[model samples]
Target: MMEYSDFKFKKMQSQLQEYFDDYFSKEDFLFTLDCDIEDVWNLYLDSFPDEIKGIYHEKPWHDCQRCHLWFKTMANVVMIDDDYKIRTLFDFKTIPEYQDVFRALDEFLKTKRVENLFLHDKHSVGVFRSFAEYDGGFDENHHFYLDLPEKFYEDTENLASELGDALTQRQLFEDTLNLISPDAVDTVLELVHSNSLYRSIQWKDTLEGLKDVFEEFSQLDSNCDLNNWLWKKSANLPRNITHIKNTSMGTLLLDITGGMDLEQAVTNYEKITAPTNYQRPKAIYTAEMLEDAKSKIAELGYMDSLERRFAKLEDISINNVLFANRDVRTTLGEGIFDKLRKNVSRKVYNFDEVSEISLDEFITNVLPHAQEISLHMYPSLKNNFVSLIAPLNEDAPSMFQWDNPYSWTYENNITDSLMKERVKEMGGDVDVDLRFSIQWNDGEWDRNDLDAHSTEPDGNEIFFSRMKSKRTGGWLDVDIIHPEKGKTSVENIQYKHKENMIEGEYLFRVHQYTYRGGDNGFKAEIEFDDTIFSFDYPYKLSNKEYVDVAKVELKDGNFTLTSICDNKVHYLDHAVHWNVALGDFVPVSLICYSPNFWNDNEFGNKHIFFMLKDCINDTNPSGWFNEYLNNELRPHRKVMEAMSSMMRVEDTENQLSGVGFSLGKLGMNKITVKVKTNNIQRIWNVII
Candidate 1:
């Protein structure tokens, strides 16, 4: 056996390169010869250890039968059973680490060879078979030899010198073998020469049948770059390559090209190109631009000053008296009286003399009138100026009260209290007054009485009168005397209708009385009798109480005296008149002033006559009279004609008042009637 020395290592490397060059082209190959013990250890442990193990241990013994079976199974399945005409080696049981190394080298070499084959013979399908099977074991198998070029030998020797002699001969031997690509020699030749090589080749073709039944022993090492060739055409190669080198290869390409293995190269690149902290830049401004802005600002300030001055001058001309007399301040401030004085002074003397008239005197007389006119012309101006000048500390009396022109001073306490009391009374509450007139005349007496009073008189006659005039007719010229004063008397007077047997009484007196003697007093006589007069029924004054039938007689002798006493002889009812047809018996009832028709007999008779005429002459007779008359009289020709004409009905129908009626047959009967006679006449009509 050749001792594993440096010279032997050199020879082995040369042969390995030569074999690789024969099968693979130069551009498609990656050759690495790391002589350092650490580099060689890492390459065996990291990059391609399985290939190294296959080469040494799997070829030496079959002590581990399972490993050998696994290798055989993979080889048979991938080749014979699958009918894949590919070259495969199952030497992993002999040297598993060396098998991984050989696998990696074979893959790299196959890629290169495929490219060369494609370029040379366009019809070539490339290597077609290219995997290495590893079982287990690293130390013995990783040092297997392969053919290499002479330049590889020279490079290996130089690397070993650089690494020094501290490395073991076995390590150097393994590293030298790994440096040589696996595709460098004819796989067929190696298999034929080895003891179990033919069996290995045959097992590779037949492994497919055992694949489903076999337990896979060698797991795919995820740490290896199985798809490194697939990424060659990618645009993101740099980032992807860096990632693969750091995580999978454990070394960078830069360090590897500098004679380091893949793992050490990546570690060194990371150390050299680590990121640094960032710094921020400072801000800067130009002084020239700042100066230019300031200059523009100064120009704007000058323009603003000129504008303010022009505005001040305009204000003086438009608003100051020195510039224009008709300006607001001058005309309003100097007022009408001042203007009048100024005109007088101007016509009489010069401007200097007119200026001598004090502003106080001018404002006192003239400003009041001018303010009145200004209130009518420019009302808002007076308010605006008052509001504007009111806050000023300067004492300008003109501005103090200029806003209100109608303001007047209350001088005396009497008038002030009166006015304030009037306002307070008006504001206190609401009140209403109702007034009515009552007129009557006797034989030698005629009287008209108008009574006016309110519930809330408040002892203020003027106020009551004013309110009363507003409610009733116009202003009353007659003197009014209260019931408390002796000027007017109040008497409880009653009125009764004898025919209706209804009566009512009121507190009656003259509201205003003038001196007229000889029975010129208002008297009301009341009496009650049976057979109530329908038209003369008494209505209640305020409550339901019948008045006494005693006559109330008031005599205006030296003064108006009213008497109210119950004397039956003095009592007389007012006459209630009603009209009836010739043969119709009306069941006569009279509300009259005299029961015996002796005292005041003319007045009673005249009242009855007038009321009868009114009833008979009334064109539109009411329905109440129609029912009474129709029931009392058996319908006669004259009565029917008179009723029809009065009711204004069609001539073909007989109507009483406005209601139609007809007489079917008259019943023959004799009726007797008693009658009363007056001094004028007494008559009776009998119907048979």
Candidate 2:
């Protein structure tokens, strides 16, 4: 192998530079020099022909071609530091093989006694010659110069001394190989046998050394198995023991007595003492013992019976002995023997066919009639059917209508005299019955007298009257009697008496006047019993009573008679009265039919009002009466029907009294109206 010291390596670099400068300029020289050096170094090192190439490769020096080439290549180089300095001038073109010429120079310098030297290249000399022949003059300043300093000799000598030591070491290594031992050879083999510490040792050396040791061992014992020893130490091995023994049998071991062949010995031992087969073992179960088992099972006669009867016996034993309880069976013919037989057989029923029976059949036939069925069947079916149909029947009867009229019986009565006292205690009016009536006859209070009298009447009137007993007539005899003829007429009369006096009356109008779109104004007429009293003067009455008789002719001389206040029109048509001191006012009542009725009037207009218990002074009677008549009269075409539909007054102390309209049922007419209070105030019904 080629060897290099630090000094020889530097000298080689210097010589390579000078050789390049001998034929090229400084710019081209450095560029090509790196490529040439790499090429030569690779050829010297990579092509070295020897099994042992270094201190690591133990082959002799004579067999190493690389060392010879290296020395031959260096023989021509002259060892002068300035001549070999790569940057100095040298005439390389003058010498045919410039590298060979330098090698020769190198060889001569090592032996010769030369001291100071200067190097010049052919290119530098040519440049000087060309300049010397110029017309003006030869300026030597432009030509390349070589100067050898005195210290170059000392440096070259130091470099030579170091190179000499490296050569001496190579020589010492070549002479020591014969002194190694045979047992030491085994130790070396062991060191390389998969030992990580010896990984740096070359594989070629390890294998050759191991082969030599095995050969020596083989000769000592002629019957020894070299192949087995090598196989055991090999990097690769057969996967199974049978294959291992077969491949290395005679070569790995010697049979001295020949009691049995290697294969038979292994087989005999395996058959008698192998892992006990809890059951019979199979021939091809595991790949490692497949070949041995193939012949062994047959030679023992276990194979013939295994195919014919053992497989069937194993399947039946697994089904009966191991898995017998897994299969469910139905019992028939009660007894121990029958149960055992039934348990051996598995049976199942079709549930779809079973569920199709009727309830009676399920209870009578499928349940009680079947011998082997669950006892829970009846109650389970009963619970399911009850869960399905109970709610339907339980909710059915409430769907029918039942009567629930407002009852005046004691159980239903909700009146309170204490509530009336509470209103009075608050300084409020508490009178619950301030009654008034509109009559259409004139007898006692004549219309002509009041219309022509000096007492100018208010536009409305309020009066209080009390009845006096008559001793001449029986209580039942006080019936409807004629007043002054043609004063008033009555129809559909309902009468009732209490304490020798008739207390109530219900009558329809005998005659009514219709005005076509009358202008807004106040007009009123009053009839008491039979008297006709017409009033245009606005007046108010508080406490007064006078009786007179009058007559009115209508419907072709059918005379109507009425009694009234003497020359006093105590009541009037289209008039309103609120008894503030007595807390008596007409109690209006309301009924709604739908949720939307409160949004508009029952007639579908938005006009509405409240009837209160105390009439305020500034109330416009004409306007108030007109609105009441329009809402209560015009819509339903019947005055009684409109009066019945009125919402009842709910009394509050601050609310103004007397009749006025209120917004009625909203989106529908069917709704609930809460009266809420007994002391009268504003009144209206709410729908929805």
Candidate 2 lDDT for residue 161:
67
Residue 287 deviation, candidate 2, in Å? Answer: 31
| Error in Å for residue 343 of model 1 | 99
lDDT of 2 at 218: 45
TM-score per model over all chains: 0.13, 0.13
Q: Summarize candidate 1's per-residue lDDT along 28-129 as a digit string, tens digits.
A: 322222123233233333463344345544243222233333222122111111111222222122233244554653343333211100111122211221
lDDT string for model 2 (173-219, tens) is: 22212223333333323333422111113332533543454454446
Overall lDDT per candidate, in order of appearance: 0.24, 0.25
lDDT of 1: 0.24
